[model samples]
Target: MNQIVTFGEVIMRLSPERNKKFIQSNRLEFYFGGTEVNVGISIANFGGEVKHISCISDDFVGDTAISYLRKFGVDTSSTVRSKLPLGIYFLEVGAVMRPNSISYNRSHSSFSEIKPEMVDWNASLKNCKWFHWTGITPALCEGGYHTLKEGLVLAKKKGIEVSADPTYRSGLWKYGADPKETLSDLLNYSTIFIGGVNEMNEVLGSDYGDSNEDFIEAGKLLLKKFPSIKKIFDKIRTPINASWHKIRSRMWNGDEFRETTDFDITHIVDRIGTGDAYAAGLIYGLLNFDDFKAMEFGAAASALKHTYEGDVNFSSVNEVMNILEGNTSGRFNR
Candidate 1:
């Protein structure tokens, strides 16, 4: 059994050529990505025993996804295969003054239609110490919602620590009930919560501005509302351009506030899925180190994600430790 288990959908991402819109691109790049799956891949790359639990289509695309995850040493024995088609999305990477856009075509995907009995919860998470999920799972469909609830219940009963990322996607939840009600119900079972202020406001029905003060107040209010939650990890971002960004993060760990300095990244190969990488890094640090060290490790991991092309972070544990030790000189190998 692995130490970590993550559950979510896996989709094949098709992104347009550089500096081109979806309509103008003659060819697109293909990669397999999902929030939870990305986190699992990152953890596995850092030598963590990670298992991914999700439904995949019994097709070539599904096989490709499984292979991609296995390349990073992730365990996929608990994954199920169904007859439904795999989900896909088209991404348009922004340039200059433009912003990136994603158009998903994933209705009735095998993972979205997953039910409670489809997964062997007891065996899959028997020796797991940490179980992870995201808001997108419950927003998939009513069946997905029940399945996620069942997984959470089983994980709690088995004494596994659970973490959740409230990555609220408005379009994904259109087929189901309101995101607010659904996410609130799930948060009750979550031990660690990760999201931005905008997402928190959307899911928790709060009308707050985007300022440091607002976020601190919101964090205090949220902790009071959700007593089971022990920590809130917030990723802060500042866009310098389409190809550059400045990133930092802060954590509200029940008793004290901790933050890391901004990391200025000059080249961004792919901006998508960095948040998931940060979450995975934070989870690793929290499991192994103290609170302050965890925040620095997580921020450094997120900074490293900008240099990679795909969504899954490919940096090693040594690289992350070096960055956490304040070696940002970027010296090449001797």
Candidate 2:
């Protein structure tokens, strides 16, 4: 019963080789990743048993995607197949001051057709100790919301620890469901909140400033409103530019506040899925370490993700520990 369960869409990502724009590159590289899948894969890479449940197209593309997950040691037994095509998004990786741009083509994809009846929550969460989800799934469509709600309800009944990352994306909530209401309902079943002040304010509809004091007040208020939430964690990033950024994390465990020092990443290979990396690290850390150390591990994992290309964070636990030990010299390994 120590397995971790992740539920979300599995998307195909296409990007031009190098930092070139779409107009400059004739060849494009592809990777299979989704927010929850990235987290599951990263946790598996860290030697944690993880299972990802999603609906993928019944085609060669879907076959490759499932293979990719298995290649990272993630269990895909819960994955369902659909006749529709798989969802895809294109990325134009940026450098320096230029920012990365993404265009999504997932509106009518296979994952969008997911229904509550399509998944057996009881079976999917079997032997599960932790469950992870994000706002992205619910934002996709009405069925996505209902299906996730079903899983959350069952996961709560099983007494599994649930982590909610309410990534409010206004653009994706085209299904007419109120974002705040949807997220607030899901939070009732979640034990951990893996997002920051902006995310808190979005769900709470409160206007809190960006200071430590404000964060504390906001966290306290959030826990009060949603009594199920035992801890709140946030990854703060200060971007000097698209390629250079500083990252740190903080947490409020309904008792005390803890923060970590800034980690400077002067060169970023790819920024996609870094937040998922943070969430993955936090999930793995909480299962093994104390609250504060978990937050530190999450921040370190996020910093390391910036140095990798593609959508997944491939850093091992030892590699993340090296970052936590302040060993960012990038020296040769014996």
Candidate 3:
């Protein structure tokens, strides 16, 4: 079977010790992560054959980053190495009422300097069954955007399914074009889209109502606008505090709405990469299960992610199924 391919930047994550604020902490833990990389890790954990494409500095940090991915079962044979330094981000894990904070030190990093000319679209995507990327990629540089677009076109030509998450971080798109236009341009090639209802209204001039009914209406309009889009998925979060939250996922498959069981998360280990976990689960489910099952599988995976601290969701498929099968009792295994 061909592998599922992902393209993006992988940064070195620096976080204070668990539950410690940055200003008060004297120690930091290092981990390599990025949106696409996180998703690739989850998919790989589930025994999916996955490959990631990106550039890192030709240094010890870059070598460690690639090895970190290899440890998680992701193929990094296509990774590029340049003279630039690796991107870095500082994360401060928060407690009740205090939110998590991220400070990026990633400007002009090796990954940001990568151009379309640096990658071979056909060779990278060859024999790939699915191609994945996010809004974060194009935000890096003009060459990044062109490279992503080229990859999308090449994937389509290769008959590969395309999945995308419109992460929609406004600050990332400061390279001179409106995020709306840029996102729409890339998303036009997507078969499965993961984004929010309000994002639709804010990004495009679409007036999908603000309420539940509005979301359904907006979903319909989105399908109409992008005929190739087969499934639209998003989740709703009911935060009880910084540590606990109620979450569930919903999807519009052009035919009907598919909803998942409501999930209550009483503890959150690290919320940073939970969205990517959800996306990975959804993508994995879509490849293996029906739409109804896929929705719940994704939500269950996210619920399990809340119990672990890291950029990757270490939860196994059995664990996710255990949660989804109504086995919420966190019992010990004999």
Candidate 4:
């Protein structure tokens, strides 16, 4: 069986209890989140052999993250335990005209202090068919960028297929180096490019059009520029309100662009890590199927993420298949 390994920071999300504001709330719900780590958990939940590689503090928050990943069947052997504490973020879910807000306090967390020598790249990626990562990892700090670059180089040297999601977070890139310089350097090693139009434009220095059609065109241009990129996956978002959203995705498979229609979700319990869920679904589809149906499958899985609360999507293969089969009635089970 093929195995996938993902590397990035794991944050402990502290969100206001219920629909209350952070200042008004006394209790906060805790959840484990990180772009690449969330993808690993989703892939593992879908029956994929997945491993998460990152450094976390030996603190309680780090332990919680480890326990959470283990519960989802993710291998933690590659995780390094440090004396530093885990990073954390505060989330305020929005309603009505207000939009969701997040405040981060992740300055010198264990993951940010990850040094290249701390990771045994050869051993971590051994027997792994696919190695995955995100641009956020490189934006953490100088050490973080070095760790990501080293991991990618090792994976390439071992002939392991690499997938990267240049998921740009402006706040996260507040370190010394600019994201454009770091991301451009990293893109040279990526086989799969995943991100939104704005993110691609910012990282690749390409003129991505504003509209979705133009975005697809820009993606095609990117594939032309980088011949090594076999596939380009993109997620489309249409916000109805603070509590409702329509999400979908498109893929340019170096030949033709395939798209899935917008999935209108009524109630959104949590919306933090939906993009990672979509990426995981896309990877699964690319590895398992050849047809364009993968786009729809990926879109359905992302839509299902809105119904649940937390960073990692808790969805099963059967539920995704049911949605793909056009069963959106959402009948309750006994």
Alpha carbon lDDT of residue 199, candidate 3?
65
TM-score (C-alpha) between model 4 and the true structure: 0.96
Candidate 3 regions exceeding 4 Å error are 207-210
Question: All candidates: CA RMSD in angstroms?
Answer: 1.6, 0.7, 1.3, 1.5
- Predicted candidate 2 versus true structure: per-residue lDDT over 1-334, tens digit per residue: 9899999999999999988899998999999999999999999999999999999999999999999999988999988999999999999999998999999999999999999999988898888999999999999999999999999999999999999999988999997999999999999999999999999999889999878888999999999999999999999999999989999999987789999999999999999999999999999999999988999999999999998988899999999999899899999999
Residue 237's lDDT within candidate 3 is 75
**All models: lDDT?**
0.84, 0.94, 0.85, 0.84
Which portions of model 4 show Cα errors greater than 4 Å?
Answer: none
Ranking by TM-score: 2, 3, 4, 1
lDDT of 1: 0.84
Model 1 residue runs over 4 Å out of place are: none
**lDDT value, candidate 2, whole model:** 0.94
Clashing pairs in 1: none
Candidates' TM-scores? Answer: 0.95, 0.99, 0.97, 0.96
